[model samples]
Target: MEDEVLLTLMIEDLLAAEGFDTISAAHETEAMAHAAAAADRIAVAVVNLHLGRDVAGQRVIRALRQHVPNLPVVVITGFDSEAPQADLRGLGGPTVRLHKPGGYDELVPAVLNVMKQVRTGAWPEEGRRKTDYNV
Candidate 1:
């Protein structure tokens, strides 16, 4: 989920146009609530790294994983260099990292790719902790 209303709207519209239904959350709490409630229906998650104040996207990802262990995640961030890439390595599922602003170009493709992997049983690698993409 994205914190910025406009960006979230843009993403929602984009995904909707691509024929995918979307659920949006402006912060971690809303994200967690949505994820928990729809854990069985969610196919993948597109998250922003910063959610204002001290709320990080990684927190949302981790929280969702507690309910859906194999959830695929597309992490979009404006602070590419400042993001905690090292910490994300332990996320234990399929994850795609992208820089914001320009990263929009790759968002849809990334989501589709992750979904493909998930459907093909290529995600959540066997005997492996995690799978990282575009990091």
Candidate 2:
């Protein structure tokens, strides 16, 4: 999920073109609704660190996980450092991170790679890249 409408749509289209369906949400409720509604269908999640101006980003991840246990997450942020969002680290299951403006180049691979890792149960410790953001 991403807060900016255009970026959310862009990411949706990018994934759609790659033959993946996406649920785009900018707030925790919308994300939870999607996760609860399509728990079995969701294969992975690419979440924006700052979901919206009022939402706590970590809440979004937590909500998603409540429905989909061990859900592979590709956490994305625009910040250069992750010191402020230290809570995002050590989130359960296999999570991977990427910094914007990585564009689709970095996103597609991260999404696919994380899903592959989770499915095979071989998420590399080396892929644990993190960054910071706020809501």
Candidate 3:
């Protein structure tokens, strides 16, 4: 949970209560490091999309996936409109993007669903497509 304020703390607390081992990071560097070190050990990642101007959490997702490509990343968005959902979904990984203010109950199920999909090898591979776009 590498977020500055608001939902990060709440989500972390929720995860802890659910009996999951958790860690926190407030920026990109720390998040990447944590993900790398916690690879295989971490079953799921609950990431917030807007992690400052540079899309830091997106970087974390890429790096973590490089380490564990099949890793399930549950993207959290605070946007009021549905526009970001499409963009977030196209991030090309095993993911679930939820719009807020989504409750902890909803959050936990979303996280657990992705984790279940991952554990059962039921998730779709990121860039696999039927129609290839050749340059």
Candidate 4:
């Protein structure tokens, strides 16, 4: 999971504690590198929608999708809103949009569920579309 330092570390720790082998990135460039190097090992990406830069997260997601279309991405944002969540939902296939300041327990289930969908080729509860949403 590649993201800014703060989110990267937080997610890494959480996932690591949960027994997942984790890698992290602070921005799109590094995230791509990480993804490239660990292509087969990474099961999913827990990305922060805002990387404290100009659409860095969006670019990262696009690149990841191009390289590994089946790679599940769960976009996490501190800001919670229906529009942004709906926008991520527009991104077709198996991606999840979640709000932070919630519980990591919630995140765990979301991560597990999305990855399960990817592994099993199952669609999420609601069918989603591929659309660009500003985080």
Q: What tens digits encode model 3's per-residue C-alpha lDDT throughout 70-128?
A: 67888776764345333543244567767757545588888888888877878655655
Candidate 3 RMSD to the real structure: 4.3
Q: By TM-score, how accurate is candidate 3?
A: 0.76
Clash count, one per candidate: 0, 0, 1, 3
Cα-based lDDT for every prediction: 0.79, 0.76, 0.69, 0.68
Kindly report the root-mean-square deviation of model 2 from the true structure over all alpha carbons.
Answer: 4.3
For each candidate, what TM-score against the reference? 0.84, 0.84, 0.76, 0.77
Is 1 or 2 the stronger prediction by lDDT?
1
lDDT value, residue 19 of candidate 4: 90
For 65-94, candidate 1 gives per-residue lDDT tens digits of 888887888988877554454247556568
Model 1 ranges off by over 4 Å:
123-135
User: What's the CA error at residue 32 for candidate 1, in Å?
Assistant: 1.1
Runs in model 2 with CA error above 4 Å?
127-135
The reply for model 3, stretches above 4 Å from the true place, is 80-86, 89-91, 124-135
Superposed Cα deviation of residue 132, candidate 2 (Å): 15
Predictions ranked by lDDT, top down? Answer: 1, 2, 3, 4
Candidate 3: C-alpha lDDT: 0.69
Error of 3 at 30 (Å): 1.4
Cα-based RMSD of the predictions, in order?
4.1, 4.3, 4.3, 3.8
